[model samples]
Target: MPTILVADDDANIRELVCLFLRNDGFDTVEAKDGKEALTVYTSVHIDLVVLDIMMPNMDGWALCKELRKRSPDLPLLMLTARGETWEKVKGFELGTDDYLTKPFDPLELTVRVKSLLKRYKMAFTQTIQFGSITLDRKTYKVLCGANSLVLPLKEFELLYKLSGTPGQVFTREQLIDQIWGMDYAGDDRTIDVHIKRLRERFVGTPDFCIETVRGLGYRLEIMS
Candidate 1:
């Protein structure tokens, strides 16, 4: 069973969330503050975390950053009273996989937790296959039917990241930080350029396509 760390200042909310998660077949660890949450996280093998933004000792933003630094792929879901667009954007920038405003339904939270876990599992695999295409992260190769093609390092990493979590929209900033590193002092449009190249290269292929999500960033969609 996957272990979930529920960190919130409110004991009632923590208990309620953990109760629902436990009822749905997940083991949970609870912490009333971000400091305790971090300590619990380091000591326990937590598969995912549900955290609130405002807390004593340490806030969710700081905790999120610390956790992301420690475990790049660890799934984080933020629960907060603030539903502002900037808050959501900041959460994503800090490496949160999902966000839910306060007063949310427990059932909705459970569903989101399962979705995040599923996405995390898919991303943890070294190789991912959709239709006729196979992305081998170990060798950095794209195997489509009889052909084995190599992409540029950046392009390959971008594709691998997107394909790892199909339908998950990743902002250009997230892509740059994850793929190009935080110190990458370049224009974000580089992501667009790389996406274009990947699309042109795989245009005739029916396996998947990289989609631009208008105001958002991009997501990989597998062709049916």
Candidate 2:
């Protein structure tokens, strides 16, 4: 069973959320504020975190950023009373995998948690293969037939991320955060340049292709 960290200042809300999660078969640890949450998180093996925006000592935004820095693959969900669009945007920018407003249905929250976990599990592999190409994350090398190609760090990471979740569209902002880090100050178009280079590099390979979703983002598709 996955252990979840539930952080909220409201004692009642915290307990309620914990109760629901426990009933749903997830082991949980609770924290009253972001400071306590960070302590608990570092002390234990937490698979995911559900946090509130407002808290004394430290706010969820700071906690989220810190947590993302600690574990880029860890799942984070923002559960707060602040349901504004800007708040949601900020949460995503800070690396929250999902968001739930106050007065949320416990069932819906559980479903989203399960979904995030499933997605994470699917994308956690160290190696991926399609057709004749093999991407080895441990060695940061791509093996194609008798040839082995070593790519730049960013390019390899971007390719690994896309190939890990083939056919899943990733927004430019999402790519930037996951690949370039949340603090990256460069233009988002840098992704485009990298993508173009990747396309050129693999033009002769007929196994896979990366597609751009008009006005959305990109997805890698297996040609075979």
Candidate 3:
């Protein structure tokens, strides 16, 4: 089960959030302040953080900055009583994945948490494995038994996006737009080149392979 840290100065609010998350099949750790949140953060492999903005000891903005420094991709959702537009803007500026104003329905909170975890699977989550292949997304490294390789930026992102949703074909245009950006002036062949490199790097491994979807696109296939 995934672990989550709930940080809020209000003990009641923290416990309530944890209870709802627990009911949603998640293990939750609680912290009453930003300082405690940081301490608890290191003690567990927290999948996501649901924290309030106005925390004691340290505010959410400060802690969010600190957390980003430690793990740039960690999914963070802010819970705060302040519903002002500027406050939400500041939270986003601080790199929060989602922000829920105070008095939010518990259902929405759960939905946001689930969304963040799903979206950031390659970032803060543990190593992803498909058969003998092991990928540490945080470090952009791939390991297959004794063989290992460090991928280039584009190659790493290509692999990550493909593996993100296994067996789902991503069209060449879609890959270019999403990975290379819509402003990319390069031809569609740019994606093919990156895919080719990924295949070459993992060619010797039987654990996973990129399959050509014939006239359509490509998909990451993990073999049995």
lDDT of each: 0.91, 0.87, 0.81
For model 3, residues 27-105, the per-residue Cα lDDT tens digits are 9999988899999999888878998999889999999989977986688889989778667656655656577888999
**Which pairs of residues collide in model 2?**
none
Higher-lDDT candidate of 2 and 3: 2
* Tens-digit per-residue lDDT, 181-215, candidate 2: 87999999999999999999999788999998676
TM-score-sorted candidate list, best first? 1, 2, 3
**lDDT by residue (tens digit), candidate 1, 94-185:** 88888899999999999999988888898999998888788898898999898999999999899999988877778899999889998999
- The predictions' CA RMSDs to the true structure, in order, are 2.1, 4.9, 9.7
Task: Evaluate model 2: give its lDDT.
Answer: 0.87
How far does residue 189 in candidate 1 sit from its true spot (Å)? 1.1
lDDT of 3: 0.81
Model 2 lDDT, residue 76, Cα: 89
Once fitted onto the true fold, the runs of candidate 2 whose alpha carbons sit more than 4 angstroms away are 127-174, 177-186, 192-224
Clash pairs (backbone) in predicted model 3: none
Question: Which residue pairs come into collision in candidate 1?
Answer: none
TM-score per candidate, in order? Answer: 0.89, 0.69, 0.57
